[model samples]
Target: MKVLVKLIFLLTMTTPAFAQADFKTEQLKFDRVSAAYEEKWNSLQEALRSAGIGRPFKLYMAAYKAEGKLELWLKTNGQKTHQLFRTYNFCAQSGILGPKVKEGDLQTPEGYYYLNVFNPKSSFHLSLGISYPNQVDRFRSGKEKPGGEIYIHGNCVTVGCIPLTDDKIREVYVLAVEAKNAGQDQIPVHIFPFKMTAGNLNTYLKQFPAHRAFWTNLQTGYAYFEKNHMIPVLSEKSGRYLFK
Candidate 1:
């Protein structure tokens, strides 16, 4: 009877992930990109595997080009939370952050969006789409089209989308799906500058002087999130962020 109980316990512990998502659609993405991103992905996997969040935690990045660099981070637990994880070069040919107001502008949009789906039929390999033309962007641009097609995809090349390389996106895509499956909804993405760490600020200060105001705004949001471990409802009072 004791032996039989041990066998059943082992089977239960080693049961297959039959109910978990099949991220086959995102394979072969994210082989490489920023070392920091890779490291974070591994750590996240280990954490989930250990915590057994009973599901994967969704990941999100708010990519921004400040001082000629592209940076990203991870957000989890639905759209209710976020955390700073890594930074990298813009790697975009066009140059800079903010919406691509017009074609060939070479700028990645800045603001709140969500990773809604994984696109296997992507020109840049696998792609995680951004819900662009968000209300804020719409009001900011005041343009009906304001263009779309933003993504965090494979292939380290960009016109208007982010390139995380085929290998890298594959990895990122899997992580993202895990995060969504874990969180139970679309992942919230808040694209912003390097979040202005003392070091980050000093590093890009020269290249992105115009971005100081933006980065400063992010500092407030970053500080609040860092303290609360939850994404605060940002309220604007005379162009200032007041946690709601």
Candidate 2:
């Protein structure tokens, strides 16, 4: 009876570690993910070390549709600001510059989101799901069905999604897996129509006048991060985004 009790105590003490292990273990069960780790993990780890970021660091991602660029930012655990780590080009483009309004709009959404799913068996090699149609999107759509199933994926083909090509996604997927295994439950992903620099905004506003109001709202968040390199706390109010 004493030995049994001692064994149970040891298992209980290791529960959290086991929980973290389950995520990676299950992910590695997929062939593509295992291959990604085999191909990219060593180089990625070296890059992380050079950046002064270690395992369990936080990740923040941002994408610019017009520029066809995706940027990965990282910060060590307990750090407040994220530093730019790398940039990947979007291998394909979809709809014009604007927020996705309804199902089949073919417009990749623009707004605050997060990685909500990780699919190691993705048809496009591997993919990280984006949580779109959040409260703000629903509020804006009103009666329309805001489209769903957006992702940062591979394959270099898109109807209304960001595609980074198979080779690039392998690197990104590995980094995301490491971050998730480190206990990042909600990895932030912010998508914008374009880099919201004043010059770019002014130029685009003239060509796409209808999106002026919405883009202006997005600029506030962009400017905040541009100045601080920190994610801004945002709230949705009656179909509009308010940054705090």
Candidate 3:
């Protein structure tokens, strides 16, 4: 009787049914989004091919607050470098140029982050959550409140998040899902105050001296990618970003 009980437990734990249940959840999300975006999905594929990028390619995103643009970068499998894929404009903006420090500060965060969640049935149409209040933010904002729930979402409105139009977000969301399905995990999302050009940096420094050091550190990662077309491995030490 004990042997039979153990055998049944092993079977239940190792069966494919458990795995299929998780897969079905992801598939359902894809199907719902695909149903609403069949045409856009087709066009995205064509655009990818035209740009010489293939499906399931790794994706990197960079958002510039001053420019109000989100640039998508892609690299095909086995490639050593990424290429510019598309740029989406922000439909709305909020707060001023700075990192979000508190829960109600109304400031969009500025730093390196990743897409940590997907909202298929978002009230904003569809949303990609950004991993904000990251290591640096936590250290700077303290334990009491560092804010949360930052996202690159749709709805054309924002208090402390990046917003895109409903139609535009569908394209972004689809690309994110396809990349995840393709096994490119940890999609990097870098948010910058501006393009990080020499002139822009100098001007920003003049206007916001307090942020100069932080922005300077961010520029290191920015320059590394600009020169190599590859995302650098980043680490935090003493609340500062150390790019490897």
- Candidate 2 has its poorest 10 consecutive residues by lDDT at 49-58
Q: What lDDT tens digits, residue by residue, belong to model 3 across residues 156-179?
A: 989888898888888898888777
- Model 1 regions more than 4 Å off: 1-54, 67-93, 97-99, 197-219, 234-243
Worst 10 residues of 3 by lDDT: 19-28
C-alpha local distance difference test of each model: 0.59, 0.92, 0.86
What CA RMSD would you report for each candidate? 8.4, 1.7, 4.2
Error of 1 at 140 (Å): 1.9
Q: Is candidate 2 or candidate 3 better by TM-score?
A: 2
TM-score ranking of the models: 2, 3, 1
Candidate 2 lDDT (Cα, whole model)?
Answer: 0.92
Instruction: Give each model a TM-score.
Output: 0.62, 0.94, 0.88
Quickly count the clashes in candidate 2: 0
